[model samples]
Target: MASIQLQGKIFIIGEIEAMTGLHIGGSAGELDIGGVDKPVIRNPLTREPYIPGSSLRGKMRSLLDRHLNKPLRRDRPQVRVHECNRLADYKECSVCQVFGIAPSRNMEDTMPTRLIVRDALLTAETRERFNEIDTDMLYTEVKTEVVIDRITSAATPRQNERVPAEATFGPLEMVHSLYTLDTGSEGSVDSEIALFDTVLMGMELIEDDYLGGSGSRGSGKIAFRKLKVIFKSRKHYENPQSVPIATLAEGDGVSALRKADYQSQISAAMQA
Candidate 1:
């Protein structure tokens, strides 16, 4: 076994507020639905709408893959993980370096993933006051949608559940570990900045791409706000410094949140 040194760790924490009705569909088992076909996922214990980290991470990876024009494997059902062995000489593959590759080819090669995205839960403040604002304890708003038959000009109505626009969910956390290679460079990608860039790129892409489902019909629009990046070192993990990053808030809405200086803030965190 080879020795791998721990370099540093960066933590990004923020809130995700729904701009429009957001619907990340959950299984509609045998539950009777009067007219609803799809339903948003809820925490089994609280029955509150929560965003799964897997959904966010997967969407970001796919978006980055498309943006970079990286060749994707057609054999797999989900997005393909890039191989560090496949790229050209001396070139760092951003996606693979950040997200990492699982062991394959008889478990011969493996790249440990660096990024960790935790499930986002509704903030306590919002959860408590949701009923005051929306008059629903479930924290979800029901949207009635109509599908018009183009040829017959007939309208068929269906009900969809969504997290209402302007609703906030939070403490969304993303932790990225930095490693120093044996050759003294920061992992195969050579710089932590590259990894941060990849993360921000995916985040920005999601703002345009939309999350969950029914994006074309204007569902799942969201924005990240109050982003704070913190750095921790093994020697002084107890006393970590918060990186002075700019807030994503530009105005009172989602559009303002999208124009955040994510990269610049990350750069400051890296230096700190």
Candidate 2:
């Protein structure tokens, strides 16, 4: 058995705050109401709008895939992680390396997925604010939109329920792992840092893009706030006294995301 050098894991935690009214559609079908064709997804227990981890993670993977320009194999338009090894080969693709690859039929050789995203719930602060508002009004706001026919000038109306702008949801958390193996290779540290950088870049890409649904129609603009990544190792877990890798800077807003220095700080922390 080949020995594996256990590199530390990074936990990126923060708030995803809505910059514009955000609508992540729920399972609710066509309903009889003021043209409310779609409604925001909610927690069954709290009945409050929440961002599912799958929604955020899927968007990140898609954006990264687009940025990487890695399209599906001509023969295989869709491939599972297991199938990834045989068809639509992306064995070396960084996006796949981080996000995941479908398990191969054998499944013995597949690497574990490095990224973990948890469902983003309303922040405690936001929950408190909801208490001040009428419980009946706590449900998201619904916006009615019209689809106009360009030729006949006919109008069709549809409504979408959305989490209002300025509302915050989180401490959304993601874990990215780094592993060094026995295979002949270049510096693992640099490789790990590079992978982490890609994760950051993915978040940056999404900001220019959007979150949730109907982004093109001007919904789902969001920003990560107080975004910080903490590094932990097996030793730290065992001893509980060992200091973790230096803490990352808080992601203030979209502006902070745009700064080149933000990327540099990550590299510096890793090297330190």
Q: Which candidate is the best by lDDT?
A: 2
> What C-alpha lDDT values do all the predictions have?
0.69, 0.72
Question: Best candidate per TM-score, number?
Answer: 2
lDDT value, candidate 2, whole model: 0.72
lDDT of 1 by residue, 1-272 (tens): 44566555667778888888889987777334433567788888877789999999988988887788777664478646544455341145778767776555323323357899999988887777776774432687777789999999899988787888887878888887766555344334246544665776787788777889889998988888777666554433534444333332234333444455644554444456
Worst 10 residues of 2 by lDDT: 79-88
Which digits, one per residue and each the tens of the lDDT, describe model 2 over residues 1-272?
Answer: 55566556778888998999899988765333434678777787877788898888888887887787775443356652221454235456778778876554443444568888899998888788767775323546877789999999998988778888888999789888877666425366457556766677788878889998889999988888887767765456556555456565456763563444533454454444
lDDT for residue 164 in candidate 2, whole number 0-100: 83
Task: Give lDDT: candidate 2, residue 13.
Answer: 84
On the 0 to 100 scale, the lDDT of residue 44 in model 1 is 80
Clashes per model (N, Cα, C within 3 A):
0, 7
Off by over 4 Å in 1: 30-35, 76-91, 105-110, 133-137, 183-190, 238-272
